[model samples]
Structures are given as structure tokens and as C-alpha cells.
Target: MKSLMKTALAAAVFITASNAVDLKVLITDTLKNNQNLKADRYYQEAKQKSFQSVRNIYNPKLTGGLNYNRLDLDVRNTQVVNTAAAFVKFSMDLYDGGKNRALKNQKLYEYKAQKYQNISNVNQTILNVVTLYFNLKTIKENIEVYKEKGRALKAQYERIKSKYDLKMATQEDVLKLKSEYEANLYTIEELKYQKMQLIKNIELYSGVKVSRLDTSVIPDTNVKYSTTSDIKALEENLKASEESINIAKSSKKPQLKIEDTLSYYRYSDYNEKLLSDLPDKQNQLNISLTFNIFDTSTKSKVESSKYIKLATASRLEFAKKQAKTDFELARQKLLTQKEKIKSLQSAVDMANSVYNTVKIKYENGLVDNITYLDALSKKIYYIALYKQAQNELQIIKMEYYLKSGIDYKKLLSLLK
Candidate 1:
């Protein structure tokens, strides 16, 4: 029997050790496989391609074509004529009133903005995963507390039942103990359901089935807020919007382009004599200048672009303020949760001492069953509360880290 028990205990220990996952590994896996982050990366790549396309807007273009014509004339005499022509044209925009440059700048800023946006998405996803992971740990700890309470209540109920059989304890006492045990059992079941849901949510986000999560990781509480990706992305967008305004303004300026064409023609008919004056080969070069001097549409577009720039500027300001506000709030919550945890720790210690004293007295027949049960329940409640506070404190720390723009990888590295 002892050998079997030892083997079972060893197996349980081994399973627990094997299931334990580091917080850093969990976060790294989440970043690698998260669908939303992958989508954002793809979007960033597309924006980069668009930026490159914009830079090549002024590349030279070459075009070639062939044409055939046939004619029969009966005016002076019967004549049959056929013509075949081939032409090659090369064209390039030498100047576009600086519009192309502004467009390229806009796309460049947009691409940068997308890169920062991806970073922001990653940060948010990390926050969600960390929060959910810790929440599951908290719920599981609470379940254990309830289970312990249930066990204590069950032992007390058995003792009371034995006393009632000897007419030493009342039936009411036995029923009360039984009721508390049942209630604790119900609470455990509810908590287990909650844990199941949390596990599912974590699996959905991290793309892995997590059997155990390490809660020993701690974050630096002294971290301070700084510029985050959200603010940077908005700043880039503002620059892009400003470039749009410049592009619109440039549309009113003159456009200059150069074109060169080479042509060859062949004629094989009776009308060749009449068409002998036509050149068999020709080359032409042309320079064109176009200016929209009286177009109301260009003016309207310029005004619209300016308005959009203003809006973008407003959004940037708002983002900065929001980031600051979030950081302050998270820091404040962290401080509050820290204090709460300290107080709950003290309470738990006191509750444990009282429960131990009451249990000894009840065993010596110096205290009633109800008193012993109350002491045990108090200990369990305080313990559960303390664990919950600790979990909440960790969550707030994570929020503070995220809001402060601290690198999550660095934060995870601090885990020990």
C-alpha cells in the first residue's frame, strides 16, 4: 500500500512539473501564432510594397504598336494600296509639380504608421493573454480554498453526527454543518466551470492548450510611462495627412513631360507612286507642359486635404492624452491593489492563527463545533481573498507595464 501511494504521488509530481509553462514562453508563443498579429504583419508588408510602388512612380515607360491599312481608289484610275506601320514610343514625366514626391512621402509615412500599429496590436494582445492567464490561476486557487473549506466542514459534520447519536449535540447543529459543506461543494463546482471557461479563452488567444501556468513571475513596479506605439502611429498618420495636403497644393502647379517616338512604314501597291512623298522612316521628340489654371476641382481638393490634416492633428493630440490617462490609471490601480494585498495578507495570517487555536480547543472539548467551523471558514475566506488580491495586483502591474510602453520581452525576461 505504501509503495502504491508513493508511486501515485511521484506520478502526480511529475505531471505537475511537466505541465508547468513559463510566462515568457507563453507570451512568445502567443506573439508567434496569434491570428490578429499575423494579419497586422501582412498588412504592414502590403503598406511597405505600396510605399515602394510610390517611389517608382516616375519610372520611364515604353510602348510599341503596329497598324495596317488598305485602300482602293477609282477616281483617276484603278489603284490598290496597302500600308503597314510600326512605331515605338518612350515617355517620362520630367516634372509633376512636386506631387509625385509628396505622394511618395505620404506612402512612406503610411508604411511607418502601419509598422507602429502592428506593434500596438501586439502589445494589446499580450496584455489580454497575461490577464486571462493570471485570472485562471486566481480562480483555480480559489477553488482549492473552497475545497479545503468543504473538507473541514465534512469532518465537523461527521463529528457532530456522532455527538447527536449520543444525545450530546443537537440535530440543528448537524444539519447546519451539513448545509455549509454542501454550499462549499456548490461553490467549488461553480469555480471549476469558471476555470474551464478561462482555459478555453486562453487557448483561443495563445493557440495552445495550457495545462499549467507559472505565477511566480513578477513585474517591476517602478516602471514609468513613456511614448508608446499608439502615439507614434498617430504621429506618423499626421505626417501622412500633411503630405496629402502638400500633394493637393502641388496639383495647381505646371506639369512637364518629354516624349520620343520612332516610326517605320512600308507601302506595296500602285498608289506607291502617288505616296512617294511620304517618309518611310520618321523620328519625333516632343516636350509638353500642362497647367490647370482655372480648375475649381483642384482648389476644392486642396481645401479638403487641409481639413483632413487638421482632423489628423486632432486625433494625434487625443491619442497622446489617452495614453497618458491610461498610464496614470493603471499606476494608480497597481498601488491600490498592492495595499489591498498587504492588508489581505495580514488578515489571512490572523485567520490561520485563530483557526488553529479553535481546532485545538474543539479537539480538547473546550469549544463547540459551530465555533470551530466558523474559524475554519474565516481562514478559507481570507486565504481566497488574499490570493485574489495578489492576482489582481499582478494584472495591474501588467497593465502598468503595457501602458508605459515597456517592452514585453524585457518584462518577461525579469521573470524568475
Candidate 2:
């Protein structure tokens, strides 16, 4: 049944849009279009019905029938007389090994587990959607970065051509600038394609078209610059997993149940009456108990659940170790990007100084355009490198938030 629903959802959202829409709008539409959400809701509702399914008082049944006695003896002028009876009987289950009660508990726990599972699913879906959103955001920023570089290079290319016309600049410089401009254009095009692919992923998952995006902001979840935030969340997850193991273990014990029954009946006779006893309004009562001493097949499930719980604990431990490593790596990477930014910032300033001074020299015919253009190009490149350095810093810090469990809404709030 679930596989069929998933297939339906797949067919519904299979097509990608011709163009992208706004991310938030797309999310809203996707939720509306999401057949999977509806399926989850239906399953949850079915689980809720289990509450109403708790064993209830079943009413006793009353039976009625008619019959004729055959006696050809010449009695009562050989008359044909009618005979009828109205009787009530009570029935109850003696004991089915406490299976009903156990079933009820199983259903209850299953319902609860499903609720938690749904919460986890929502969290994961939000993560995927937000990741795609930010992925597009990153690509868009890179596109702008390249566009800025292209602008600078285009201007330099024209200046070099002018210098070449004056026989003051080599063809090599002009060709280099042209090649750089083309490369920047190509980079921009690639970034645009990447951004669209991110949008395509969002559409496939959310089942909505993405039209526009608010890229003026970025996520800045202020993670407690602590040493053990990820560890803390992992610990919580482990505890929950442990409790789940307990729930599964609870299933192995034999179940016990108690039951009772009661009822009444009415009667009448054809031609008033011909019976040994009248329909005697009767009452009934009963009690039952049962136990299952052996089921080798079920033991496997208990063991499997236990092993999964234990594995979760082990995974948490591994994550703790990985977090420590990431902490050190983040520290090193951020420091490197920072030092590089500082170095290149100074370089840009010095290059700008040189370009200005040399521009003065060129105007005075003391030097040529080639020298001035080279200095200008160096300054622009340094500025571009500085932009990359900033992005690298943000990436480093983003790790801190992600490790701290910065979810979509929280991340969105930070971006806002």
C-alpha cells in the first residue's frame, strides 16, 4: 500500500519546471501539492482510529424459529397446530493467549513510533529543502562574483586594444584580457546551470515550482561556540533510541486479559402457545485467561531491534569523535582563509596605489598604458580573491551552525 502511494507521488511531481520560482513560494506550493504529505496524514489518522478500536462490549444475540409436529393419530380432529420458539444465547471468547491486549499495546506503540517517525521525516525534508535553497544562493553569489570580474576584465580588454592601436601595448596583453573575459562568462553560465539544478531538486521534492529567491540574506545561526553541542544532540538521540529498545522489549512478555457477558430475550407462540418452557428472559456471564510460552520466530525481531538500538549508540560515539576532528579542522581552515584575506587585502591596496601612481605617470608620458593596465588588473584580481576569502570564512562558520543542529526555520531566521 505504501509503495503504491509513493508511486503516485512520484508520478505527480515527476516533471521539472521550465524556469525556477521563489524558494519560499515553491515550498508553500510543494506542501499543497505533496501527495506524500496527504498519505502521511492518512496513515496518522488510521493510527488514531486504533484508539476507538479498543475492545468494546459486544451485544448478545436472540434467535427465533418455527416448527410443526407430525402425529397422524386421530387426535383433536387430526388438526395441524403451529409451534414456535424465541430463544436467546450468549457467546464469549474464552482466551486467545492474551493476543487482543497485546495487539492493542502493539498498535498503540506503533502509532506513537509513527508519530515520532513523522516528526523526523519533517525535520529531514526541511533540511533537504533548505539545503537546496542555500545551494542556489551560493551559486547565485558566485555568478555575481564572476560577473563583476568580467566587467573589470572587459574594461581592461578595451584599454589594452587602445594601447595596441598606439603601438604601446603588446597583442599578448589584449589576448589575455579577452580570454579572461570569456572565462568569466563561461563561469557565470555554469553557475546559472547549477542554480537551476538546485531548483530542479527542490521541485522534485516539494512538488512545486520555484520562481524567485530572497538571496539578500544568509543563514547566521549563532551557535554556542561550545565544544560539545553536537554531542549533546547525539546524546538526546541515543536516549530516545534506548527508550525505543525498551518499548520493543515490552512485546516479548505474555499478555493477560479478563472478559464477561450478559443478555435477555422475548418469546411468543402461534395460536398463543405450545411449548415446554416460555421464552425465559435469561442472563449470561464468563471469564477468560491465556499465555504464549513459545514463539521462536518472534525472538528474531526482539534481537534485531536490540541490535539496532546498540548500533545507534555506537554511531553516536563515532559522531562525537568526528565532531572533535571537525572542530579542529574548522579552526584551521577559518584561520587560513582569514590570514589569506588579510594578505590579499593589503595586496589590493598596494596594487591600487601602484595603479594610481602609474596612471599619473602614463598621463605625463613618463610610462605606458600597459604598465598602468597591469597594475589595475592586479588590484581587481586581489579584490576578487578577497571575496572568495569571505565566502570561505562563511563556509567555516556554517559548519559550526550545522553541527549545532541549526534547522531550517532557525537557519531561515538567521538569514532574515
Candidate 3:
């Protein structure tokens, strides 16, 4: 007996601990460990580095290498010569017709676009976590409702079976109650299976095992709107496209460059003696400007970039309109769920009253087993509906917040 009691105590403690988990904490952990988010962050960093790489055009580039050459003369009195040279070259682009500046801006805007895209991905991950968490919560509550109904049916079945043995109740009555009780148990099992599936899904998103979910509290339904990452990302893309036009135009202008080279040369004859008359060390500098006199490709590239910018601008406008539409729809859903929850609560109450009345009439032999069973079924159906509406209200509220561009953490704080 002591061992059994200890086991029960431990099981209760475990359940309580699991139920104590906060949804916000799970979301935080998920955001921290999500592989997709990590990949996006790395990609954003790479874009940032790419932008930095092209930001400075005046920086000088230095390179050094060694070269070896051997010449064999076929003519008379011509000796074989071997030459080895070590050379260092320094080069700088004095001007690129604003090409490098435009390139830098393009990279910078591309990085910004990626940065906002990462933010959007984070929001999506949070929504996934929240959705799964609430789904588990709803399933858990439904399981409890089924368990309660199962217990009530179990007692009613036992009572009917006793009455049948005494010939006071018909065999059909006993069989019907037994069937209902068994069905209730099956439903509970099915719900438990669904709960298990939901838990696994939560783990898939959060990278943490979920034994239970804490959703006794619901988030506030108040919604607010602000700029969303999706729109920001598109705006950056449009800016980058505008910069591409400048980059293309720069290609049509003059490009100037400066280069200097210092070299040490070693000359040797067939006998390997140094040729003293030949110059050994030399320095050379060159400054040149070049222009693409007339290029059909430059005009085509400029036109393509302008078209890209126009396309992006159209997409951005569509995104803004879509966001507005979604937000309004989410608000409508939230309000509908609120009304449904209120109506279902009243329905559950009425159904429970009707069930109590029918149950009393059946116990007194005033009503048939079918009526009693029907009332019980109606009561549980209403209860399930009420619970489902309550859960859906929370989900709708989250949807509303998401459309409003409110951060999930802020929404979590609003949860009572």
C-alpha cells in the first residue's frame, strides 16, 4: 500500500511540474534553437559581409609572384638564356564612374532585405510554436471532458446492470449504458492519441520534448498594427533594384585605374654566369582610363534593372493590401469566436440542466434509457463545443495579433 501511494504521489508531482511549463518559455527556446532561423541568421551575416567587402573602392590591392623563363636559340652565336623574376604589383581603381558606390549600395540593400526576411521567419516560427501549444492545450481539456463523461457513464452502467439482474431494468437498458460507457472510453483514448501527436509536433518545432502544455490562461484579444517584416523586406528589394540601375549606368561611363610594379630580374648564360650588362631591378607605373564607346548591352541592362524595380514596387503594394485584408479578416474571426464562446457556454449550461432532469426521470422509471442517453450525449456535445470555442478564441486572438505585427512575446505578456 505504501509503495502504491508513493508511486501515485510521484506521478501527481510529475504532472504538476509538466503543467507548470509556460508557453512563452517554450517559444523563447524554440526561437533560440530553430535550425531554419539559425540558417537565416547565417545567411544574413554573409550578406552583411558581402556588403562590407565592396564598401571601399579606394583601397589598394598588392600582389607578388615569381616567374621563370628558358629560351633556346636555334641561330648560330645565340646562347641559351634562363631568366627568373620576382615581381610585386600594386593596383587601385582611381575612379569607376560611381560604379563601386552603386554596387556597395546594392549589396547593403540586399543585406537589409535578408535581415527583414530573417525577422519574418522568426515570426513564422513563433506562430508555429504557439499554434501547436494551443492545440495541445485544447486536446488536454477535451480529454478531461471525456474522462468526466466516461466516469458518469460507468456509474450509470453499473446501476443499470444491477437493475437488470433484479429484473427491474430491461437487458437492452443495461446493454445501451454499457455501450455508451465503452464508447466514451474509446473517445478518451482517441483524444489521448491526438494529444500525443500534438506533443510530437510541438517538439518538432521547439526542439524540446513536451510532456504537457500550460494554456489555462488566454492572451488578450486587443489587436494593434504596425509595419511588418514582409513589407520591409520588399521595400529593401525595391531599393536594391533602383541601385542596380545606377550600377548599369556606371558601366557606360569612363573607368580609370593606377598600377605600379617593382621587379628583381636574374639573367644567366649557358654556364650559369650572371649577365651584368642587362638591367636587374626595375619599377613601372601606369595610369589608364577606358570607356565603352557604345555598348548595346549597357542600355539593355539599364532597362532590365528599371523593369525589376517597377515589378518590386508592384509586389510591395500588393503585400500591403494583402496584409490589410488579412488583418481585417482576422479581426472578424476573433469577434466571431468571442460570440461563439459566449453562446456555447450558455448552451452547455442548458444541456447540463436538461441532462440532470432526464437522468432523474430515468432513475424513477418515468423516462426510457434512450432519452437518458440522448440527454447525456447532448450535454457532452455542448460541453465539447464550449471548450473548442474557448480554444479557438485564443487562436483567433493570436492570429489577430500576428496580423497586427505585434510580437509574440508581447502577446504572451498579455496572457492572463
Candidate 4:
């Protein structure tokens, strides 16, 4: 009982560990190093500048100046235009109410929309990394498959050669098997080179030493792939677009602001200087309001916003229709691929059985070496065909999953 419990605990510990996935971890690492994400982060930080709306309040302007010339302390009848007077003027906004408020509100929504845009972009990046990783994995598996088949053919060819030397088989039979095995070997080499290229691509996307990393994740048959709900996604996108239109229109309304400033000024000569500690100092302050009432340009802006809103609505409807078509299309392709795989599997099994029978006949001296060699050739051909069918089916399945936005993490779990 104690031993059994310990074994169970060990199994549980292993199961609880996150599946060792080099590609997923590499993707996470790459996103951190992504220059685009870094730029988006900077954009997010810049959103803080919107707070200036509250502080840098636009105020009206003021003008003031003085001119003076001392009368000549000289001969009689000499007079100088000498006078000095200072005036303070102020202009303040009393009524163009709520325009600033609209501006600030629009900007707020714009910032939020940008945040969501970044989120959507990040999701796409994740998908891209995952798809590329799987493509490389598929090619790697092909290389292994070819290599294993090649080894089997090599063994069979050696057996045939020994039989031929013993005068039990024709030279033709021996040469044919040798040729097939050599072809398999050539295929293996080709696949190996292709696999090397895939590894290089993996390094390119991940920028990591994948040679030192864990194996990529593979899906198990036990897990299921769920199709995407296009209706739901389209609804969400439409809602976001609606918010965008609202943000655009918000720019048309009145806004609120408050601003205060302090500065020092110096002239060639001055009686009242802003920086001086003297009693008579010069400074000015005012408040103002701005309105965009008669601009014909805003009409164009409103039209564009309305058009975008309409366009989004239309696209959402079209997406619903397109989704239905795509779902059916994928369904048809999947069914076709499955049937093809099934037919090829059956053919391979029948050919294999026929080859075994021919082998028995040749051993009993009831059939020629040509018949036996032909059977084996046919069996091998069928096996290769079956493998190719499976590969094609796998690719189509992947496409279906991608199109439907199916999450395969549970599929990953089954591989363990």
C-alpha cells in the first residue's frame, strides 16, 4: 500500500507540473522583447499628457505698453513729448460652455480604444508565433517518419540479397529492393535538410537557443477542438466601433479648462520689471472661452464618423454571413480528408496482407521471385501513400482549427 501510494504521488506531481513547452515559453520571451509592444507601451504612457487639459487652461489675452521722454532742461520754448501711462486689459470667456468637456471626453475614449487595439494586436502576435511553431513541428515529424521507414526497407533489402546469394531469389528482386531502400534513404536526407531549415526559422522567431530548450507541444487524440463563435466576436467588434464613433462625435461639444502661468521679462530699459523686487511690478492674467460654432469643416468630420459607424455595422453583418460559409467549407474539407485517410488505411492493410501471402507462396516454391518482390513493392507504396494522406489530413485539421480560433491547450494535455 505504501509503495502504491508513493507511486501515485509521483505521478500526480508530474501531472501537476506545467507541460514542458519550449515554443510557448519562447513565444512569451519574444513578446517581452518585441519592439512593437515596447512602442505601444510608450503610447500608453503618453496618454497621461491628457491630464494637461485640466491644468493648461486657455485664457484670453491682454496688451499693455508705456512711452515717455523727459522734457529738455534747456533753452526756453523747448518741449519734449514726455508722458507715461499703464493700462491693464482682460478678456474672459463667459458662455461657450461644454466644448472643452467634449474635447477631453473624446480624448479619454481615444486612449481607451488605443489600449484595446494593443490588446487585439498582442493576441494576433500570439497566434502567429504558435502557428509558425507548429509548422516546424509538422516538418520535423515527417523527417522521423521517413527515416524509420527507410531503416525498415534497408533491413528487408539485406534479407533479399542474402536469399539471392543462396540461389533462392533472382538478382532482379535483389536489385529492386536495394533501389527502393536507396530511394527511402534519399528521402530521409532531403527531409533532414528541410528540418534544419525549420530549426533556423524557429530561432528567427524566438531568438532563443531552441537547441537547448524542451520539445514543442503536440496534441493528443483525447482532446477536442471547438469552433469559434463568429457571432460573439463580431458583436464585440461592432460594439468597439460604436464606441469609436461616440468618441469622434464627442469632439464637437464644449470643453472646460483652467490655466495659470508665471514668467519673468527684461527689456533694454524698464520702469516696471517682472523680475525686479521693486514695488511697481508688471504682470498680467486673464481667462477665456473658445467655441467652434460656424466651421463648415466639422460637417465633414461628422459625416466621416457617421460613415465609419455605418461601415462597422455592415461589416458585422457580413461577418456573420461569412462565418457560416467558412464553417461549412471547413466541415466539407474535414469530412473529405477523413474519408481519404480511411480509404488509404484500408488499402495499405489489404496490400500488406497480400504481400504476406505472396511471401509464403515464394518460400513454398509456388510463385516466382517477381511476384513476391512486386507484392512487397506494392505494400511499401501503399504505406507511403497512407502516410502522405495522414499528413494532408493533419494540415487540413490545423487549418480548420486556426480558422475557428480553436484553443488546443486541452489537446496539449492529452499528449502527455
**Best candidate (score: lDDT):** 1
Q: Write the per-residue lDDT of candidate 4 for residues 32-136, one digit (tens) a residue.
A: 766677787778667646634433223354545454445445422332223344555444333334334444554555555556556545555555666656555
Report how far residue 321 has shifted in candidate 3, in Å.
1.1
Number of clashing pairs, model 3?
A: 0
Ranking by lDDT: 1, 3, 2, 4
Residue 400 error, candidate 2, Å: 2.4
Provide the overall lDDT of each model, using Cα atoms, as 2-decimal numbers: 0.85, 0.60, 0.84, 0.59
Q: Report the lDDT tens digits of candidate 3 across residue range 253-359.
A: 89999999999988666443433356689999999999989877999999999999999999999999999889889888887888888889889999999999998
The TM-score-based order of candidates, best leading, equals 3, 1, 4, 2
TM-score (C-alpha, index-matched) for candidate 3: 0.90
What's the residue-level lDDT of 89 in candidate 3? 99
Which TM-score value belongs to model 4? 0.59
Candidate 2 per-residue lDDT, tens place, 210-302, comes to 665553323444454343434554555555555445545544654333333333333332223334454444444444444545767557766
Q: Best by TM-score, which number? A: 3
Off by over 4 Å in 2: 1-145, 148-180, 198-222, 225-256, 259-275, 278-283, 293-305, 316-344, 347-382, 389-399, 405-415
Weakest lDDT window of 10 consecutive positions for candidate 2: 262-271
